[model samples]
Target chain A: MDSYQVGTNTPIKLKVGIETEAITMTYPFLYHSEDDDTPYSMISPFDPAQKPGWKQLDNGNKVNGKFFRVVSFLRFFNSFPDEETFNLAIQQVKDTYEASLKGGDVSPYMMAFELKSFYKDKTCVIESELLLT
Target chain B: MKKIVLLSVLWSSIVIAQSGTEPTAALQNIAPPSSPAFVLMDITPSNIIVPENIQAFSLQTISAFSGDSSNGLSNNNYAVEFQPYWYVKRERMDFFKYNNLTTQKADDSEVTPNDYTGYNIFGDVWKRFSVSMALMNGTFDVLPQAQSYVSVGARTRLLSFKTKSQINDIKSQYTAYTTFMSSPEVIAIFAKPGLSPSEINTAITNLETYKTIVTDFENTLQRKPVFALDVAAAYSHFMGDKNQDLDDAFGRFGVWASGDLAFYTPTIGTNSHVHIYGVFRYLRDGLNLNEASDLFIETKTDYGVKMELELDKLSFAYEYITRDADDNNEERSIGSIRYKINKSFTLNGGFGKNFKSDGEQVVLFGIQWGLDYEPSVVLGAGN
Candidate 1:
């Protein structure tokens, strides 16, 4: 998945195969450059009004001698009946990203994100962050 | 890869510990709505409406500080409710579709609140589903002495309807919040450099405009459905006295259904409603001790109605329930009031007459509060 590279202004599609029973929350943040030493800026698509189906992220901003990185917070309702199924779904997400990358249809950097889940407010939260350079 | 592996191991261990073992302290701290103990004690109102914003986990307790032990219980009772849907993993969920935020179009840019008419408050079955367990020690009129009992209950909303006007209010609030978020000042805060995530969050939360919009939006989200139907079932087991042979005996089993009709009264208050509720319950009670010191079962049916006036932070209600059985008939008449001090705390009081109590008056008071659990997670680390 890390072999392919994504160029500036490329459009990346984010997909999760698991069927959700409730609304999924998504928060997007953009980092200016690799060594900017500043906090990431929260981009468009505000809370409670942002459409959840906007999976295609247009990574159009580019500056010479600087690299842009995106980080998204995706929160989904925990509808799985058991942990095994949850683990399988996470694997499926990774697999889908890998498949998309290997098929040469999209750049590997497009799917350069890591998925992790942790306990929050007595609930489970799955967070994904961009791992691109 | 190592972090993922470590997380998997940690999650697996946590799951194993939680699957069937004794509940941990964190699990016990989860707040709940009215529990089986409250139902058995007839402390809960007959209305039984599901809360609009159900917490993932909640804990509710009836303490002895209320000073009105009219129900023959001197000890505190504790209950916990859990909604599994919030703790499990979910897949393929489209937020816009479930929340009525968009039309049935594939294009995201074209999605608008005008395209949607109503949002069902009880649309998601998972959000409505809840399991509650309670522990209480009390003396019942049918029993010889005080005993400890454990009760388990489950409740869910089966159907609901919402008015078009309520949806419109929500849409308008959503638009207002969107505009606020898009304002240049708000954008400048997010665009400012050197501000940490927590700093940014604090700034956003402290903004008066942001706070007002969020509070209004939340109140709009909390509007009651025009009508809703909910069903619940509960069972209790007596631990029995040490000198008695009735240990682990069945205490009570009941199944009930409740229907509510709510009218939004913006004239009285922006966050106000008038609710009429009807409830029916069937129960098999086995706590009665006969002349031979043996427990006996009685089949009973109860039907009740409640009328409530709900304001933004206060509510008053009156309920009447009549019980019918082969041997006797009794009625419960109660008036209750609740005051919400804040988001996490509430005070409740009730005054009335209880069923089959030989004209004994009933007075009950209690408090409900929730624990806020927030654990921080670092983001944007490479895998």
Candidate 2:
């Protein structure tokens, strides 16, 4: 196992790829950035990393990741077991985010995504996207 | 960016232009011959007098009818009308700022009354226009606030008689208006035990008088109509709340009466008519909130002219009102237009302005739909 320490000058890339099919993950979960030099709580979703690759466009189209920055990451048991359940969970998150967007101090740029090819014991990737209010 | 903006504007202009096609129906001579008449009803009040030909009880629906839309369609929002002889209505309607639809007036000092939710529950019975009775209990939020102040009000036609002429005009009528108001704090004190004998007696007397007025009004309807008169009374029942706001007590038992005279233009057929009226009211209010507990009395007069013109498919009304109330007097003018698309659908628009303030104006557009049930149609189907 390689133990790497991140610093303030170094940018972090949250790799969210599926090794298998039929897997769904909750996206835009609460994430706080941590570097080897900065305090763990120093980073917040309000002020995301303004790096270039943080807004990479794929396939000549703008993906959801381009508009938001990864705030925090957590791995847990799948809260949504099936496609229908995953849709329902994402809709609830969308509704909450839209409601908070009206008069919220922080930008409401939260989202969730799923991969059909991923399954079984694989950690569900939870990422919080930074919105440019 | 400039190309996009220009393109968007052009597209919008094109869309509007295309939507402005002339209506297929030809404009008929739909002007109503007379203005709309005001009728006080407990449930659904209709300015259009229902003829005796079709008096069968049917399922009735009333709605806020909107006027002509750019899309050539009418908008009707159905009102939740409860007309089960004795019922309650809770309505929340606001004044419309026509020119500046997006911006509200910056002057908070000039507040529009009747812009809050109202709850009214009343019991009424009528035998055509000959005899009618209503007893009402209602709460009104005169100011736009969280708590609603309450009032008790009643209205009755003491006597109404038709002249022997062919027009059968209403020769004379006597109406009595009574209202009693009190703050929640005063009401709380009355609710408590061990109140003074006089205080208790006053509350009981007020209730008894309310009952007497209603009963007497009903009883007098059997008599012939003579010189008509109007009696109005208002009072506040204060139950030993010395710390309450002074303005709250100003509403206490103010009583007044007036002589009312009305002249009507002959009915343009059976469905249309115009009425012109004037009223001189004398008011006396008890000002006990101050240390002096002085009685304040004054006379306020008002005059108004109303016209209701109704045709088979079109109807409209115009009103000019002037009132002298206390030191601050006000006059208002209002006009409304409604086009009945068919038997059950109508489009309406209204414009009103306060003559005292140039900037105070209101405009409204609405649509209405009515649904009635005919038992004969259903019962005769199998035959």
For every candidate, how close is chain A to the native chain A in TM-score?
0.44, 0.24
What are the DockQ scores of the candidates, in order? 0.18, 0.00
Docking class of 1: incorrect
lDDT of 2 by residue, B188-300 (tens): 32332233434433443356543464344323322222223333333332222233322433333322222323232224432333333233323332321223543244334
lDDT of 1 by residue, A44-70 (tens): 644322343334433443322333333
- What C-alpha lDDT, on a 0 to 100 scale, does residue A58 get in candidate 1? 34
Q: After superposition, how far is residue B212 of candidate 1 from its true place, in Å?
A: 3.1
For each candidate, report what fraction of the true interface contacts it reproduces.
0.22, 0.00
Quick one: best lDDT, which candidate? Answer: 1
Model 2 residue A132 distance off true place after TM-score fit, in angstroms: 96
lDDT by residue (tens digit), candidate 1, B155-203: 8887777677776776787578667766877666545435554555566
Give the TM-score comparing model 1 with the true structure, all chains together: 0.70
| Candidate 1 Cα misplacement greater than 4 A, ranges | A1-4, A7-65, A69-104, A110-133, B1-33, B45-49, B52-54, B64-76, B93-103, B106-110, B117-122, B242-247, B368-383
* Model 1, residue B112: C-alpha shift (Å): 3.1
Give me candidate 2's TM-score against the actual structure: 0.28
lDDT score at residue B22, model 2, on the 0-100 scale: 38
Q: Which segments of model 2 are wrong by more than 4 Å? A: A1-133, B1-152, B156-270, B277-300, B338-349, B355-360, B363-383
